[model samples]
Target: MDPQHHDYTADPHLHASHPVEENKPSVWKKLGGGSLSISIIVHAILLAVGVVWIFQIIPATEQKVDFMPKGGGGGSPGVKEVSNKKQRATMTNPNTPRMAAKGVASTFTLPEPDAASSMSSVGSLSSGGLSGGLGGSGSGGGRGDGHGTGFGSGTGPGLGGGAGTMSPFGMVNPNANAMIGVFFDTKQDPKRKPTDMTPEKLRDVIKEFTNQGWNERSLENKYYKADQKLYQTRVYMPVMSANEAPKAFNCEKEVQPSRWLVIYRGDVVAPKSGKFRFVGAGDDVLAVRFNKKNIFDHGYTQGTTALYVPGKVDVLAGKKEDREVERIIRGGAMRVPVTLYKYDTTANWNNALGGVAVGPEFDVTAGSTYPIEILISEIPGGLFGAALMIQEEGATYQKASTGSPILPLFRTDGSLPDAKGKDNAPPFDSQGAVWKISPTSRRDI
Candidate 1:
């Protein structure tokens, strides 16, 4: 081989090219790539769950509920049933009278006026005749007669007696006194007269007393007279409170648990007849009758915690209770009967503290008065208090004045006087006939 022809293959510059190999990724790097998206999704889920949990822990707002006795229907007898649509429509009209359930009608016997005397006076005035002449007294011209020819001075209709002065038929003075009776019962006796457990007996007793023309004063002394065997008498008033009254008879015994019964009788006068709503708040059992028909009946197994003290634990820590009752009341005066019963066994607290507020919204006739009454009772326990409030339709809710009594003015004869023509008369009970407590005086627990 020639020396110049040394192998060109052996030269370093003449080599063939080779392809490059890719590097494999580590496990940590692969996982790190997807971590951001996974973290974001997990955080979002956690945030949503937190929001839902917050809502669950908070309590919901309280709502009004209808309460009825076990056997009673939605409304009492004589109350015409109307659709919700019709009832709502009627409520909007101020002039329409509410259709109240018929109860035992009250009978009032008024003395007849002497017609002969009135007619004779009218005849005499007519017989006197009139002397002509526009402004004169003598035979002619100038002012002569002592009486003016232009007008006659006659007494306007006697107060509350004239055509428009009295309440419409089936209505009574709203300011009239409510007869109230308080009884203590030991439910152990099933045959007990005026049994606190029997609603029918309670109604009968109310009717009998009303028919007998018993007033608040009269009922006060006769508390134990209803049933001396089963009932222990306490206090009676046009309006009453177990908390404020002095302890009486068997009720003073602390060891012997006793049931309570309270009866209230009066008239409710609507300024303008229309739909009215009634609301009650308190502990234990309460019922209301309008026109002698049961309109509101509330029975609760758990009782009420509206006035319960915060931080004070209760073994019967049940739900808070309340009721809303609606009724159609005729304009003018309506008979109203109210009953309150508290069973010592069922009540969580020893003392009952509660109230009834009627309509923050209701239509009423202008310049009309309404009669109101309240009866409250409680067994020996903590604090006791109660009140009844009337709210004008569309008005804001305000606490009623508790310092003074809400009572009606009376004539000298112990009868409710007509609102008309009685300007100077004093109230029958200076403190007022209605029951109410000042906010400061109320005892909650």
Candidate 2:
């Protein structure tokens, strides 16, 4: 057999005949029978490589990377960022207390921990006092270490140096001997006589006293002799407001005309030898009658009459003419006119001022100096008559007698006296007979 064709017949069992030319082998065809061993070796290598890839290599290639940098992020870790809304809420609603039911925002503004706690308490004080209380702590505390936030170094708002301690009204004049109180008594008791009062009947005395600047009413026995020029006292009844007419005693309801002003009448004395007579000549005498109810008998009497020494004195005699005979009196009788101070909504006159007198008139000024005169005289019908001369610098005077100088001066610019005709006279306590003088109209000389 030929060497190339020898196997074809020798393996007749494996092959039926020789292959056709169209099915002949390509260039990469098997060279010999040993090629089967080479194929077996290549397949075994690929199987081993696949086992290593699945079990070991893939897990090693995948990794997790960390991106966080060095220093702690955004200040201290737990420091909370306060919103503008929260800051404003704390400032505006500082007065409100904390409650569980309220929103978290509202509770934050309230005193921390507890709302009803006292600011002065040792625990709270050490922690930080309330907003307005004394020795308070820094506002917006625990925010920063004295940094951008305004609160720092243990200080509160408006608490730096030069802050004022006293209120505006607390500043008082050192030299001024101002009236701080007043007293009044209307009961007829001889032991209660006050010397400062002019000799006159006690009738209609409350009305007469109230005509002056005594805005208080019905003083107690203890205050009848208070030594101060004018005592500081509050009235039981509400007086008229500053804007209302000063002459009217606002007893809260109506201007009760029967109310009168009162002061410590110095030492009421009985006439010594000479009989108490009218100021005028014998025939021109005046008989005075006083209503006991209207009169405060603390230092005055209903029938008491001061001896009239009519010698062109500051007080003149009431003319014995057409109507009720009257006597004139000057404000010099009582040096400084008694003054009255009003109270705010809650004031106890008896507790604060000790006592008060009712019915004295006052000067009508918003906040101006007041010059008031009180007249003490006798009325023909046995009444003790009084008239008040309340003159305001720029405003109209209330209950001023006729010919009593009305001076209109500007308080702001310190303007000089600009009086015409009747007002030409120097401003003085030139009060005249007030008897038969109506509360409103009559202004007599």
Candidate 3:
């Protein structure tokens, strides 16, 4: 025992009070395993918090639903890739306003919107203005900005008055001034114009066409209707000998000159109560109807005097109308054979410039309105001319150089002299008496 004395001598007093611990795991180590234990603890705390929020707290408040569009995926929010047909914006008006019923009209074009409505409509642009009052917001509006898909900055295939705006009549000229000239496009139909048509055939065609296939009982119908022309203040186109064409009043270009027929119908007021007669002429054909009664019918053709004679219409002084009267030799009456507007009568078939025919007398009171119709036909499509002169019985007129009276020009408005005859007609005399137009006239009884 005394030889190995150092075995237990060193830490006897320290070990007596505190015992040495063993190399084993602690209780905290048993609870906290590793990083996995820490991760599990964190997830458990989060799940507990989430359960409290969903089941206990959230149930007491109003829930807001956020609906996501379904797609070809896992029922998540996404955009749908599909297509559908687009349609035009039709005209519609709200007659009965409700969630189910809205009065929809199909009229695409409207002159203007309804003023008697508090709401608006959707349609084509207006023509002029509304009949009721000013204008409301139609498809576009009355030349203003409007609401509802007038194809404003919305995304769709909606039609707005096309692109900008459209006129009512496409390409039409609704003008009003003097007489209305109804033009018949006879050249459009080959039967109306034949290949081998002569002056006689042309004359017959014109008569039949103007008569709506020649109803000899009367000469007015609604068979041949075409474009119209409203002559200026007066229709004093005395002649169209040089193939001058009538231009469109709206457009600047010349149109519809030859190979057509036109019937000028309007009211003409008598300036004075006297025995008045129509001294008219034409190259192919010229006929006048006063008060719906045929007054004169004559033309430069084979049978000039054999046309229909209606009412008091007759050959003036019972003489030939196709031949011009050689009145004098010089300036003085019954003195010299002075030529008036005719130097080479042979060039135009010895006619009075355009072929004169004095009609019968028709009594008209002053300031009275009477319907007058003048028809001029250009059948051959070559050179054409027409004129209308007036003569009052017992009224003395100054004689021309040819000793014939420089008669008054029958017209509805004022006259502007074309001395050089450049407008496809003979030079007119503005100084002569001019017949004027009247607005109101009684219909034929």
Candidate 4:
């Protein structure tokens, strides 16, 4: 312990035996070796954890919806309807005979079948255009009975009331005038045409179809639970009954204009201050509403129903013409003697169904918006269309080939659909004349 004073030269034996223990392998070296081993072990553990964390699979987190579902909390208190809706197919203005609302001839007579030919074959060729030989439609539609799904009476182009081209888009309206169109599959609704188009029937049908509670004020219904509930601006679908709307408008699940209804309701802005009337027609039903009042109520099936409100309905109801109208509408598949009515006369149009009809004149303040509800319905199927036009007092228009003055189509905007030929051209003259809508219509979309 007290070796500081004892010199190594003085004690040679002790010094030789010990020899400073070969520098005692540095303390720093020992510490460094131990630290390096600990560092490696710690790093290895951290790396393994990192690798496991990175490579491990994590499940997708599910989103939760917290709310009560239809039919209340329990199952099956009431029946829930599940509708299979489809998207629209491609759109093209194919030649469809069903769109012959404005055919060239005011009169159409079915040609007597060539007994010698079609009886043996022809399976009722139904191609809509000129594709058939002595039958069927043209435009690439194959030979008879071979045109796909169903059979129909053999007829040719320019025949069977072949008026002119009844284009799908006969009128154009602006987005402001556009209304929300709600389509209803009324096959389950027991009520017939005119009634089915009514608000009462709509409520009943919706109540039966939906589990949701309904009230008179609500336009909402189970039918609104649709993906295709798009806005409709123009009322120029003359060939809607011709199996075109479902394809033309790209409305998927809704085929066949029959057993169906579409109600269009929205605010219409007045373009000017004047006495104006809505003029046009529908195959089955077309009812217009302004300020909760029925402005125009005319359709094919309207004649079939009892006259509930006489004065409010077709102004010419009690006359002899209505009886004829009832007969024609109730009659099966006849296209002629289509409905034509004015605010004054039913004598000119004995059969009231598909031609132009005028509503009573109403006053509107310039630029003021008014609520409007329009309904187009089909009860009995086959060949459907509706034309809506507007006319101001003393407004003269281009005369159609039928010699009727072509009125401007009722529209909010100047935009229109690219319909084919004379626009079906219609009693309203969507083609010969401009499709000018209410210029004073308020533009508050």
Q: List the residue pairs that clash in candidate 3.
A: 234-413, 238-386, 328-337, 329-336, 329-337, 329-338, 330-336, 330-337, 330-338
- Clash number for each model: 16, 46, 9, 31
Report the poorest 10 consecutive residues by lDDT, candidate 1.
119-128
Q: How far in Å is the alpha carbon of 442 misplaced in model 2?
A: 36
- Arrange candidates by lDDT, highest first: which order? 4, 3, 1, 2
For model 1, how does the per-residue alpha-carbon lDDT over 121-173 read when each residue is reduced to its tens digit? Answer: 01111111111111211121111111221111112211111121111111111
Q: How much is the lDDT of residue 122 in candidate 3?
A: 33
TM-scores of the candidates are 0.26, 0.20, 0.45, 0.45
Q: What would the per-residue lDDT of candidate 4 be over residues 239-288, giving only the tens digit for each residue?
A: 53444433333343434445566666666667677787777766556667
lDDT of 3 by residue, 116-155 (tens): 2223323322222111112233433322233311222111
Model 3 residue runs over 4 Å out of place are 1-177, 189-201, 208-225, 232-235, 238-258, 302-355, 421-434, 442-445
Model 3 TM-score, 2 decimals: 0.45
In model 1, the runs with Cα more than 4 Å from the true position are 1-176, 188-257, 271-275, 293-383, 396-445
For model 1, state the Cα shift of residue 262 in Å: 1.1
Judged by lDDT against the true structure, how good is candidate 1?
0.29
